[model samples]
Target: MRNHNTLKWMIGGLVCGLVMMACSLSGLAPADTGDSEVDLQKTQLALQATQLSIQADQLAATQTAMAVPAAPAEPAAPPTSAPAEVPTADETKRVNNVNGVYFEYPAWLASDVAASIYDAPPPNADDPYFLIEVDHRVFEFQNYSLADHFLTPLINVYPLEEYQRVNPGAAAQITLLKDLISWQSLGASRPDGLPFLPIFNAAQSFFTKVEFINTDSVNGLRYLTQFQQATYPIQNGQMIYTFQGITTDGKYYISAVFPESHAILEPYDDFEYTAEFEENFLGYLMEIGEQLRAEPDESFNPGLDALDGVIESLRVE
Candidate 1:
């Protein structure tokens, strides 16, 4: 009903405008005309046309509004990259106590492996030679057949004076071992056997990754090398990583030898020691040492870092 009234008002306004236009076209004043009914009909038709045009415009406006889409939401920020995690020491450690001395080894080394402790005989029976062994299973060697089963992997502790006292005949060897103040002063000649220990055979070789490591009570040198009596190529199950250190008080000596293998090395020690090889044996050993030194600690089985952790936890008292 309100819309009908609004439409009537609009028709009346159009009719007044048409009347004025007609008077102007006819050159007369806007007064009552003889064709008033005809003018009224023409005004109503014009009003309907104007209303249709308005309705079309409103319909077009509504369709345009529906066609357009809302603006896209802002993109989320890129995720931040996290820093590389630093390796931590294993929480599970086995406290190894032997001959009143104590240290820790990884619990993994003791699991599923034969371990024993014995008083190894020194050159002088009076000297103390405490030894502990962990069987070969502890090391995952590719060529276990080539390993020295008798040696296994062992840690030994000895009284410095008694150890030095036993080999009285070899005064030069004893003096050299005693004078081992630094690895930098190490001569071209490597020790044939374990430092100050008896040797059935000795290997002439160079050291790799040589570093001085001190435990809670001792200070010593740790290095990786193979013990070969002949010109044997560096192979799996033959490389020995050993640590030799003296107590801070200089009263006791400590040594730990662990068998390690590398995937980069030959699976077997099958190199022929020909005359040419003998001539360049030192060069061969140096090249091999360089290759081993270039590799990161993780390259070896049971990792050198893990062994260093064991040495760091030692307490001779």
Candidate 2:
């Protein structure tokens, strides 16, 4: 009986030991799996947290870049100026004076036929003309014969005849003479006996040229003309001439003289001798007037009287 009891005790002890060992093993296995799962979850959570932190850092960097200010643009440059123009010397010295005039005479007196009537021929081949000088501002006659013959007759007879063919009247003659004298006075003062004529009755056509120049303290007006188809009646003929000149102080002076005669009017009964003689005498007067006006002797009475003493003293010897 003692042996059986001891054996039973030993068996019981072994059974208890095995049961404890089995329970412990089972518990250990489950615990190990749970621990592994928990560790994996922890690792994933850590990784996600790290990625969120990186994203926040990137956002902060972008905000900083956007807040920065942009630089300002530069201003435009200014424009340049052009150079000024200068005037020439000649342009500064230009003159302002200007004047003009015309002279007319019978065409017959300008031709050779008129020359035969005169004992002494005139100085210039072109007689019955006028002269012009810019310095003196004067126009003087060139032929005394032509002026006297035609000019005097027209003056004396035109008034008596009333400009008609038969009896020339004094009023008509004076009127014509005055008109002629006015034209002559355009450049200079006319002679005492010379009538002033402004209208060009004998001239068929006229031309003129003008130039401007400055004189000391005075403006000069220069005028020049070329006559065409001029006509006048002479002894048994018609007279024609060309004329030109400058005017100063409202007077016309002669520049050049020319005269020619052609048969136009027939001789009238006994009027021939008287007409011829009168024409010749008047022609001489015109010639003398021109000569006196041109270069009169300083010692002469009226000619010298018109000039200043100094100028008269300087006259050509």
Candidate 3:
């Protein structure tokens, strides 16, 4: 509606300008006419009328623009180009170390991903979370997020390698185990008594399940995967996740986490939604988790084909 009125005004302005220009060219009122004061007054009023009409049209257009109509039922996502592919293992020359941790990614992502690739700050300074976007056509609105699995590139390299030994026969398959972070299964204490306890306890309210998806090796580094179920959108994509990490011992490692969705509905903080949506979404998530936990079968896809190259080519410091 506003667009239509703006166009109308624009067209009218063009006509007015043309009429004024044509009158000036044709000499509609010559200086030597010797017209009376009354004629002059009438001409002045006519000009004033034309000016007023233009002003009115301008005012109407302005008002139409300022007036906010009802918002659309759902907002359209902004257009986005494909995220430049993260470097593959083949591109030896282009492979670049990322952030301060020095993990490696394919040259394509190193060159074409986010504008801040070269200097993008580490995602988590305290417990840094590095995000590597492989696909970009998956644009997000309020927050840029992506698919259910393989949402982002993740690599967790802990200082120790023996950590994964707890899961025997983990090399060829993934075993889903509960992590202590879950408020239900564990308490807020750690043996080392690091500062992580306060942080974990602080974050406990939002986090529900923290699962370990483990494997002993993927090429050179011991593979570690973790899924921390929380109210947050990233984990909300699936009630669980399957991730990739790099570790020598497994005591300390770097892991991947991809951003997922916003709370399903807007103004999402209302309790009315929490009871209904949370239960519904949780039920959905458990169903998916069951399938993922099943004996390693043909269905599991951790995006290894796309990620393994980058991981294998990693040049970690």
Candidate 4:
């Protein structure tokens, strides 16, 4: 009888387990427990535990993704050529007692100045005895030019009226230049034989890169070209950059000439004075001018920009 009762109990437990599994698989509510409130609390706790487990897995996935490093970026290409260097004026020089003129030049160059009077006779001198105070500044590179003795860069400042009074031939040109400055009309071409004061005999030819510039208290025109009287070939160091300026009050004249060279030109000694060159020198000069006009400012030795910088920093009180 005891064994029979045990079998009956086992059979009842198996039926209960089968019924519970069937209810869970079919998405049906479990058969109600006698203690209704306790059964509801148990279901709530189980749901919360499952949600907490899912949230923990998601947080771990996010952290794992963040910890991994990203792929490195591709490097940029190298430049084809090094950039040209821009020069700076590191030294300031002054000409005292003559309109309080002062200018700055590149520190890399050697420079000096002299103040004197031009008592010599001018071809157009109104008064041969009339003296004009002149201040001359010279700048030179160590070993750049064979013609350094005459081709060194120079700056001269003097009274414009005195210069015009002495060289009366330049009076009209001075007036025209002043008018150009005042009106700011620079489109028209300037004629040849332009005077560079304190420098007689030579004339400026084939002006290129012509532009008007202003110093501290004056305005002037600047251009690049060679100066000559005869049909001379454009030699390397003979090419010059010059600035001619007048004070706003038209009292002082500032003149700057800087010798320059380019790879396109030949050295003075190397050039052949062939008869063919002389016959067509005009065309040759014009062609050279066109080439120089097209070249970048940085292409010239002691670049045009560096020379312009000195003029821009000039101050005449």
Q: How well is each residue in 180-287 modelled by candidate 3, as lDDT tens digits?
A: 222222232221110110001011111211322233432121221222223322233322222334333433334333322323312323334354545454444334
Query: How big is the positional error of residue 88 in model 2, measured in Å on the Cα after superposition?
Result: 54
lDDT of each: 0.48, 0.23, 0.27, 0.51
The ten-residue window of minimal lDDT in model 2 covers 40-49
TM-score of every model versus the real structure:
0.55, 0.16, 0.29, 0.59
Q: How accurate locally is residue 97 in candidate 2, as Cα lDDT from 0 to 100?
A: 21
Candidate 4 ranges beyond 4 A from true positions: 1-99, 111-149, 183-185, 188-190, 193-195
Order of models, best TM-score first: 4, 1, 3, 2
Model 2, position 54, has a per-residue lDDT of 18
Task: Give lDDT tens digits, candidate 4, residues 1-317.
Answer: 11111122122223232322222222213443331111111110111111111112222123344566767887877999999654455554444444366666565443344433333333334422112223322322333222342343556566677667654334545665676677664423323323243332233435566667875577988777664445556766557777888877778787776777778876677765566876676557667776777888878876888778778877665
Supply the TM-score for candidate 4: 0.59
Best by TM-score: 4
Rank by lDDT, highest first. Answer: 4, 1, 3, 2
Residue-by-residue lDDT tens digits, candidate 2, 209-309? 22222222112212222111211113311222222222223232222222222222234333433445443543433343233234433323111222121
